[model samples]
Target: MNTPPGLHLKIAEWMPENGEVVSAYDIAENFGITIRQSRAFLTILEKDNAIETRRGKVMPITCHNSHRRSTRTIKVISIDRDIIAQRRHHYNTYRHCPLKSINGLSRAEKWEFIIRNARRRKK
Candidate 1:
């Protein structure tokens, strides 16, 4: 429904000026979303071409404060307006896509839906 676009815009607005790196954890912390959800949102933004990503070195929260953990994290680049416009138009015309299914669901419900769907697919 309105959540994804609204959230996309919110994330876009919250994005740092171009060239700064943002990890999924940064987004989770800023938006109160689960890390998994943040990652999923990042994936969606990437597909929309609203954000770009690259491997980066960073500290993981679970690690010791002094140690910067090396992992597979990729930093998300800033927002792209033109891509958002194009994606928005395409989504409007094709309402049966994945993003459309969780439209009216609350965050918790959305997670449930995601998990449930994943389980079904694994069957």
Candidate 2:
């Protein structure tokens, strides 16, 4: 059988800027992997010190500037400490808003937000 899907690239892509934090669901959808797959990948990455996840408030460095003005603070996984540090510097300069957890939001809800907001800008 073929080798299993490698999540290294996905993990790299999922890493947020210095001050951002992403949820497990975010990584799954972003990498087009299953939720379980994302979790498994994250477990491995955490061990490798490729990414960091923590309880409570992970800030978002980037945001959607649409009318809805919805923001997300996602946890990030980065290979280079400098990159994350630079992003943190940028955040200091730009002042990105810190992300807050929304109670009662399921994985599906988060996906809907991404899709809906993405579509809204296409028009």
**Candidate 2: tens digits of C-alpha lDDT, residues 56-118:** 354343445433333233354346667555655675666666775656789998888768758
Q: What is the TM-score of each candidate against the true structure?
A: 0.49, 0.37
lDDT agreement of model 1 with the native: 0.64
In model 1, pairs of residues that clash are 1-103
lDDT by residue (tens digit), candidate 1, 43-80: 66556556665556654567564244542345556567
| Count of steric clashes across candidates, in order | 1, 7
Evaluated at residue 90, the lDDT of candidate 1 is 84
RMSD of each: 10.6, 19.6
**lDDT values for all models:** 0.64, 0.55
Off by over 4 Å in 1: 1-4, 58-72, 94-123
Residue-level lDDT for 47 in candidate 1: 64
Could you tell me how far off, in angstroms, the CA of residue 111 lies in candidate 2 after the best superposition?
56
Winning candidate number (TM-score): 1
Cα displacement (angstroms), candidate 2, residue 95, comes to 48
